[model samples]
Target chain A: MQRSNIYILVFSAVMTVLIGGAMSLTSVLLKPAQDKQVELDTKKKILGAVMDISTFDKPEEILNLYKARVKSVVVDIEGEIIATDDKGNPLIAEKVNAQKNHKIDREERLYPIYMILNELDPNVVEAYVFPMFGLGLWDWISGYVALESDLNTVKGVAFDHKGETPGLGARITEEKVRNRYKENKKIFSDAGNLESITMVKGEGITGLSMHEVDGLSGATITAKGVNKMLKEYLGCYQSFILNTRGLNGIAIN
Target chain B: MSAEATVVEKELKVEKKSAEPFLSKRRKNIVTDPLSDDNPITIQVLGICSALAVTVKLEPTLVMSIAVVFVIVFANLIISLMRNLIPGRIRIIVQLAVVATLVTLVSEFLKAYSYDMYKVLGAYVGLIITNCIVMGRLEAFAMANKPYDSILDGLGSGFGYAWIILTVAFFRELLGSGSIFDFKIFEAIGWATFPTNGLMVDSIGAFVVLGILIWIQRSKSGYVEH
Candidate 1:
């Protein structure tokens, strides 16, 4: 006998509810674990900006290194400390989503800075890590770019992407792309001003320049996005960077 | 759901169970055929997108393989159980929902437990819902077969797809990075001076490897497509 239309409709409705309920429950139940993973991954990326984490084969080592050498702080674009925990440490910076903060007004947005400590002098700051977020050709691309103690030269970089093409723009995640930022100063230009790094797509970067780095060969648009993100973010942190520099007894241009 | 469909289903032999072993001849064929002559990637050319996408590294390829097995087996079992109740017109929708639900759950599990692989696999893991192999097996085999046999078929096809991708990944990782599963074989053996082939890391590498693999497998099995 042929089944009635009502039977099919009822079956679909019941199936939808059942599947939807199961999926929601799974997502809710697993949310904590997923969040932890995200936090750990973010911490690793933050640490990666200051040091070569390629040798860190163990997750526990990364966490331990992060805790030992790194301090998290939240700051406004004006360079003022906004919030800190009971111990006077910054609220876990990983908890603040960079992608979300990238949207909305810049002054209202909370920026996270991971301070890398000197090995010998734990109290001394070795570098300041800044989380960067911006649009790629397809979707969001995010990374950490660390500035040295001088607050001028780039210490290192670690980038990740959502939907960049595999052989092209997605090369941002490669060590080759990241390492190009090393020793390239983003803050202090030849004219001695706070000009962020620009990615030069074409060649002829033979001269040693602090404000420019070679871009990925086939990823000009993505390179431009990175340049834009770095410029905008570094601009936001200018006041804070100048304050920090002034405190170090350096005269600002 | 329809007289014509039921009429077509009768031509295939459903084995009679008696004192037969758990792995019967027919069941063995269900699992093993796809590994060789009936291979999904090589013979049928199914799920090649992921094969090219995730096979850049052996680690992610292995994870993708396991994820596909989980998705396909569960989807086939569920579809087979609901085969009798699903209306003919909406069977495709039902299969899609079942496959999508399973893929999402699997993706969530990967995110929660294996975040690194999840990141590496990225959007490809979710794209498993669109994999023709999952829907193909659902419609062609699961709808007419018992749950147990359907699951075997799923496992067979999943493995078939997995091995080909894994093989592609093995070559890609080895030649591209001079490593296997990130072991850096060349560096370890003092062959660090050897220049790694950059081409092997690109998606084109996957195509080249899979194309050669298909050629070799087909020639060996004498299963020409002509």
Candidate 2:
């Protein structure tokens, strides 16, 4: 045991304790900022799907632009519109008997965002935007698909995921893959015209319905999940779409 | 916590101790080890996780390669410099602490300055610490060499690792993305950088890069046979 060696051990130990402690503290301090950035990024993406903003790329810029155009509302499962704050009543007054909140399997509680823009002093383009939950190759995937006043023709759409292989199946987010649903692709009509988006063996999906998106090749499971999610959630919004369209003479189911 | 600490304490009556002096041997150890047939990635087969993940596009792979090079080189130098001052039992812990700190700082710089590139890198930047080249150098050679030589040794092996990684990334990004560093070389993103030259961006681009690399390596010097 040389005297120099004794000094070396103590120095190393002290440096380790100091360095590790500092690294851990920095990460903890920065965690909030990082989390906020992540949240804002997702918010920007959501806002972008409902509105076309080819000019803006930054989230803060998108948020500013959205402030002028979009108003979010929480809605019930039925035709009646709930207030923004949900303060006035627990149940609907006019259709109190018709609306059902008692059944456990059929709960009335759900969150959906509506996009409203005032075109004229009295006229407005108000449409309810909702989430489409589905499955992809690896896990549960979800998306936001907006509809026009018609409630059938898509205004815009955005999809994201939990996990999918990078090059092969994860191409669902790519423009070409998503454009199928975005191009006035009808999801709902007088009847559920397209029961589900097509998840077929090969590409080139001819006229089945306007809403059907051809599944990715070698990614059938994910494609099926997307179809199933779109069908079920779109079904939930049917009554709201019908009520809003009928009031405006939009002819929705 | 043993008789040794007690005996050393009793003999020197010391408060703090630094690492052992192993710099000369470590310098030679790291420098000679990787260049030989027993290279870490090639022979020992370390760090292939990053190889696969970043190799898809060349820019990410190149960034990843450069990051590993920086971490390995500086960590080796810092570890070697402090080696003589490290405690015998806690040597590995000390090495890891220093290496981890350097990695975090470099990762932060990339994140704050180059946001787009940072997004592409994502978790791979932090994963540079897990790169065996850094640890392998610290443990095998960095802990024993003098700071100057140890740093050189660290960089030498780092270069050894980067040479292969960059070569791979170069081919992958160019062919895969139709340009290196995310630029479309045939058509400019806008004006100055990559003004006229932009390469096509597609999946097949990656396949072409991989094939060309395989072809180039095979057709080159005797080094390809290995």
Candidate 3:
């Protein structure tokens, strides 16, 4: 049957209303759950840098573990602690969004440092986790790099991406790939210069030096992005590392 | 009043029975033909992009298949229910609206309940909105068929698409990673050093596997393209 213009218009209008209503309703209802998921994922990634979280399948368990073993502090480029935000609210490092901070001026950006404490004794710091953000081949990539208490060696690393080609650039998330950075890799050279770990071109190369790791075979650009990310972020944290070392030395004396 | 209502219901049931049984042979054919003879991927050649993209891993491919099936079935049913009122000029628009709504719902639900799967599927989940198979079945079958028949058609086409991609994934994951569903099968069989085919892990590997599948299926079903 021939439908009049008015009829078509009405039909379209009704469809628009219905579709809009449904999508909005779904978004509103799922927003809380989705937000929680994002929070949990961030915690997981942060914790993943220092320890294996794969076995902790329950969200509550992971959250509980994070609460017990992790403490966070927000630091600036000069490694000074920022106690409050511009509006004077107490700054919580865990609540800081790394991606948003990544776009601002390096000097003004707030960096979150997560301290992983020794499980048996909370007084002893096990490792320090730093969040890194940079551009990948296709889109933004971020990672968590954990430094042992010595402030020189990389304890572990966890990488994530917004959009990277699967099986190639995306392999950065794989344990096998991430292990390249944890194989006795040192971020600081013997001369005490902060030479952040680098992902070299090509894969399966033996006898990698202290500051070098094997790169993804077909993902040279992504590997470079990761290298730059580590270097840039670690450079920002250079003062913090040195300061902490000096403070520890004084405490020991 | 109750007696009269019962008589009316009985007459309606009789009329439905006379018109067509619920599981008629033709209706069964509607749900089965797409599996082989009228396969959506191999024969209709619809939705080949996802077939090549997600088939690299069995786990993600299975999730993708279920998501597609859910979208198609519901889209088909909703469209078929409104088939009569949908004006021909605005039919495509209406169909698109319905399919997009369903796809969004699936994507949102995945994000909420299964965030890990959501991460794994990534943009591919959103890509389901543009999958031609969902739109194709709606236009070709749902627009004219009964709601129940449209659902069956959706199932047929959805499974038709599912099986082909699953087969592709099976081979790709097996050869590419030496694993099934991420289980290191070769290692379990004491072949810890099984050399996986690097090509099979790539997108090009999906094309080769899908091509071989299409060839085998077509030859078996005696379907020759004119």
Candidate 4:
């Protein structure tokens, strides 16, 4: 039996209302939890740069650990602290998603620095984590790089990308790749001078010095992208880091 | 056959079910056939994309399987309930809406509760809307069946799909990462010298494993193509 046009219209109209209502209600109800999940993920990435987050760990434990060890500071391109609004609260670093801010002007952008502290003294800063973003062979690549108190050597790094080729360029997220950045010199020469690290092709050869690490073999373009990203992001943080060296009681030439 | 008749008999008086045995033979068949003879992945060959994509890890594949089971069962029940009222012309649209809504619900719930697993599954959860198995069951079985029988059919088909992908993931994660459920099984056994197969981590590995699985299943069951 052929259904009449009126029946089709009524059925479709009812389904639209029912499905739309159900979906929107679910979305509204789950928004808070979803938002919290996103926040935790960002924190996990930031914390991941400095320490290992076990897959089995609970959110509260991770959040407590992050709160205890990490301090977020927002700065401008000129390395000046960007003061908070009328209220007397500090700006949250995770809120400043660097990838989204990448398209904006440097002066208007908020640069977040995650300070990793030592075990004994919270005042004694162990490393500074700067978020970096750049183009990969296919899409955007973003990550965190932790700098030693000297602000020249890399303590550790963690990278995540979108749409990179699987098993090739996507290997940037692998622990082995990110581990290569640990203790390697990111800035060369003087304290104030900003010489970003270079990712050279090939490995196991002699003379792999400060400011260089072996790149992924088949992912030349992605390796180059990582090199360029480090230079650009680290350069943005140079002046602030240089000025803060003395405040932290670190002797500089 | 009597169990099928009983289900059809109970269809009209859904509210007045006569305390039928929980596992009628037809209902049992509905849930069990897909485990082997009617397997959705190997036999029917539905939902191959997700089976390949998420099976790279055992944990995520298991999560995806549970998500699918929840979706298919609920969708089957809902569609079966509304089957009679639905206009034939707009039936497909209604099915799509139901599946999409269910998928979105599952996606939102995952994001809220299992953030880590949610990240691993990523867009694939949303892509569940497109998994042919869900729609295929809705149209072929649920649309003509009673709610109770449709639920069993959905469960059966879902498990059939789950076992196949879970099996594939077992091999993939073990060989690909030298791990099971993120535990370094190979290292724990002191086989640190064993070289992990890089190929197993890729999509090609999923295809190869599933291809062999299909061959084995078909051969044992004596299934022949038309």
Docking class of 3: medium
Point out the higher-scoring one by lDDT: 1 or 2: 1
Q: What i-RMS does every model get? A: 1.7, 5.0, 1.4, 2.3
Q: Report DockQ per prediction, comma-separated.
A: 0.51, 0.19, 0.57, 0.47
Clashing pairs in 3: none
The candidate that achieves the highest TM-score relative to the unseen native structure: 3
CA shift at A237, candidate 1, in angstroms? 1.0
lDDT of 1 by residue, A28-116 (tens): 99999998888788888888888888798878898999889998888888998778755776676667888888886998888888899
| B25-118 per-residue lDDT for model 2 (tens digits) | 6556656666544455654556765665566566666777788878888888777877776666767767777777988976666654554456
Candidate 1 structure quality by residue, lDDT tens digits, B1-226: 6987766665333333444578999899999999989999999999988888888789988998998999999999999998999988788999999999999998999999988777777888999999999999999999999899999999999999888898999999999989999899999999988788778877888889999999999999998776
Residue by residue across B17-113, what tens digits does model 4's lDDT show? Answer: 5456688787899999999998888988889999988888899899999999999999999999999988887789899899989888888898899
Query: Model 2, A59: alpha-carbon shift in Å?
Result: 4.7
Better of 2 and 4 by TM-score: 4
The total of clashing pairs for model 3 equals 0
Of candidates 4 and 3, the better by lDDT: 3
- Candidate 1 clashes: the total is 0
TM-score of the first chain in candidate 1 relative to the native first chain = 0.89
Residue B25 local lDDT, model 4: 82
State the TM-score for model 3.
0.92
List candidate 4 segments past 4 Å from native: A85-90, A134-141, A161-172, A183-229, A245-253, B1-22
Residue-level lDDT tens digits of model 2 in A163-235: 6554445556666677777655776544645343444554666664564666576566767767666776667
